[model samples]
Target: MATGQDTLWEKFIQPLFGFLIDREALKELSDSIDWETESDRLKNPDLIYPEYYKSQNFHGIKGGYLNSSAAVTYDPITKHALPPNENWNREAVIKAVTGNPLKIIDLGCGTGSTTIMLKQAFPNAEVVGLDLSPQMLVMAEYKTQLERLNVQWLHGLAEATSFDDSEFDLVTASLLFHETPTAISQAVLKEGFRLLKPGGQVIILDGHQKTLRNTTWLTDIFEEPYIEEYAKGSVDAWLGKAGFTQVLTEDVWWTNQLSTGVKSISNL
Candidate 1:
């Protein structure tokens, strides 16, 4: 599972993206970038966020969401990290959520990978993507604009957002929970519940916490600060406690799982 790209991700790219960043990022992939401007461009001044969102580097990436270098490398790194299966793994998430969705929101959507796929799958839907990382959102914005996909980008926290209550028809979070502490993960679930309308469903795709089927290699190569708590915990129970019902969880790939829960009418 170790791609031996550790140097490329951690050390070598560090000096490149951190200090010697090139002003123009689109022309060359290897150039270091000023992520602060990228972040400010996508950031919302009024949205409130918890401390945990700012403190940890969940993926061993420097500056976490604030690094422009990390943002550009994220998509390619993940694709190579999971290889051929990575493409379909995201597709499984979209497929798991059934019915036609009119309004959709993707949480922790990094570099617009899942966000783009979501728009492609449901072209007519008004899709919005939110991420803590403005650098990632900048990359997402660049991507969506290039593809001409009308996906909306936002800078906000998933656990707490400025959106109205029960505003979305379907809410989805991909590869988010494992990066966060268990407490924050639960808060995110509660937030998802609060955002969904009565009977609206929420979809979550993340690392397989329950099954130790084939994760040894993943741990060897990657650095995930909160993945252990996520794998051992019960997202199903969290959703239940958040007042969601009709919950279902399924394994999508060796490293991923997709879970869906309908917002309970009783909770309404």
Candidate 2:
């Protein structure tokens, strides 16, 4: 189902990023990073992530998120790749969240966009960004430091986190579900259910599903292997099955869909 553009990004753009990556600089980043502060960074745990996530050269980035340079360049590349949107970071969905959430966890938070935005909206809320890649966490952490934000980054898998049950008031994931396989997506939904306090909400912001999307060019342009399956799948049903209530989905800025739901009060 890949198009000519997909072939181009895979053949040219990906290799170009590899040439641009600085291996020497990346190797040195680990020396000063304090992995244990606030965030749980289990650097080399006995856990396993999906093979696609671990192996793919996502978004034509070299070494994927494993490369610190990829982390350094991911935001700029994606921003340029996306069409103009007034809700740049999908702030509308974030604003629509009803809870006066005091703690938030953003799963698969690449570069901490959703995580930081959540913290910016709720300054007093304890916010955490969790991702499987250390390099991505480094970029997220560096951004947090620059902004002097009280956001913490965790290096861990989204499907299975070390966080305790009902540890958060809200769980958010942006552009994550589409990249993951359906099984992994199911696991992440279950994990979201586990991580939320009773009545806590889960918000998933991702590529516009075919249900609401007019074009498939973005998927072709980016070579998203899982987009076809994701667009066809029902995250809303998954949420309900995971013991969520009042599940809803709405079209958001550009080609993104926002699915939000609450855990039942009875679960409390």
Candidate 3:
């Protein structure tokens, strides 16, 4: 029953279109909407508590767009040729943590795509996905179940996580920083510092503020109002103040950026 269009969609069009739509639509929507007014509406209640999953809509268009867009770029074969930008940074995190990880936590693990990849990369590590959206977490759970993967899904927030101090071997985030407010962003960094064990790493994979200059027209067309703010934000400074050391920042293709730092073992 499958047709050429289906194959093409599966192979190329879907991923490309999803990617374009995600970047473009998110930027436009963020710019047009008053985030302060919509913050409550956007917050998924199921995320605030685990018992409310029935109210979530896992297949909504926006959720679909996010899941598909993220998954497409996560596929190593497709991602390398297309260069989802964070490929190297992702690899770096995996290599650094996988060596002796007993457990790993992925904050803002949307649809668990990145979490799934991390699980595949290090099957020995017990991987957990934490997201504030129950809809996204549901999709992630479904996908992981279908794939027969063993991953723990938790409803949580990055700004104020439920995990105890030094609970994880590594704390990683992908494409999450730019979406939050400045204060919340700082809280996320501090939370990462608090949750990670001594000598553990906090690897961030997101858009590079500096690289925004190179894609001015694209950014404008994409309708990203926060793009400028994110470009001007001081993520590195916040991380440094949070007490992380050996900070490394790099720009990747597809406009993604990497920031890696080590938590001081002595502080723990």
Candidate 4:
């Protein structure tokens, strides 16, 4: 994601929200974490960041997700950011889930919000949360620790994960596609297809494209680089292009939408 420093979000809104958060406690938490050790534990040494990701500023943050501040402020800002409600927006993903999957992966799982929810939804499932930012993964691990949920967090890319083919029963991403270029988002869907077992499913929860195209100011509130491009495309089209069957996309909470598709039983 990229944004101008002079944008409305950067000029006023982000600062206002920053003032509202408990900075003292956030600093304390940041100081407490052994960033080096934690990052080393979660990061994949062989992983390489793409130019689009490594070079851009996300959410008006200078270092994007790689910054520790992005991790610290993510949950609080996200709670109020989602329309109607944050948990409600995320729960739409859970509601869209089709089966009791034994293995699950949440791509671009920043701070493990929806990832944790997935674990709670299916306590027995082996859940994993993967992101490009090790800083975000540290916060994700901390959040899961507070929840007492055993979720595996990994530092990796959504479009090119290290996981084997036909390994997962479910693959999901929440509010992730809008942050990346359309080509990367499409590639991620294709990667999801490769990761799923024959007859498994992929679900995506993201902004309602129709709503976004109509409501420009909604996106203007934040410095979203690819949101406009993302809004112009269709998740259904992407899923179908990735060779998923039974594709469906439905509006959720007016602002968000859930799109789902299943791999063919004979896709092995």
Global Cα lDDT for candidate 1: 0.77
Q: Can you write out model 1's per-residue Cα lDDT over 1-268, one digit (the tens) per residue? A: 2233563336444444444444355337535345666678788887666666666664566556667767876775576555357888888878877788888999888888998988999999999999987878988988888898999999888888788999988999998998888988888889988888888989998877755334654544456656666777888988888888888888776567788899878767
* lDDT by residue for model 3 (1-268), tens: 1232334345564575566555565455345534333334444455544222233222122332223333333332234332444356466556545347678899988767678878998788889998776445655776787899999887677777777888888888876776555666778889989988888888887776777656554334333334555666877887898899988777665567778888987665
Please give each candidate's TM-score.
0.85, 0.83, 0.68, 0.95
How are the candidates ranked when ordered by TM-score, highest leading? 4, 1, 2, 3
Better of 2 and 4 by lDDT: 4
lDDT of each: 0.77, 0.76, 0.64, 0.91
The best candidate in terms of lDDT: 4
Considering summed lDDT, which 10 consecutive residues are worst modelled in model 1? 1-10
lDDT of 4 by residue, 80-99 (tens): 78878999999988988887
Residue pairs in clash, model 1: 21-32, 22-32, 209-231
TM-score top scorer: 4
Residue ranges of candidate 3 with Cα displaced over 4 Å = 1-89, 96-98, 221-225
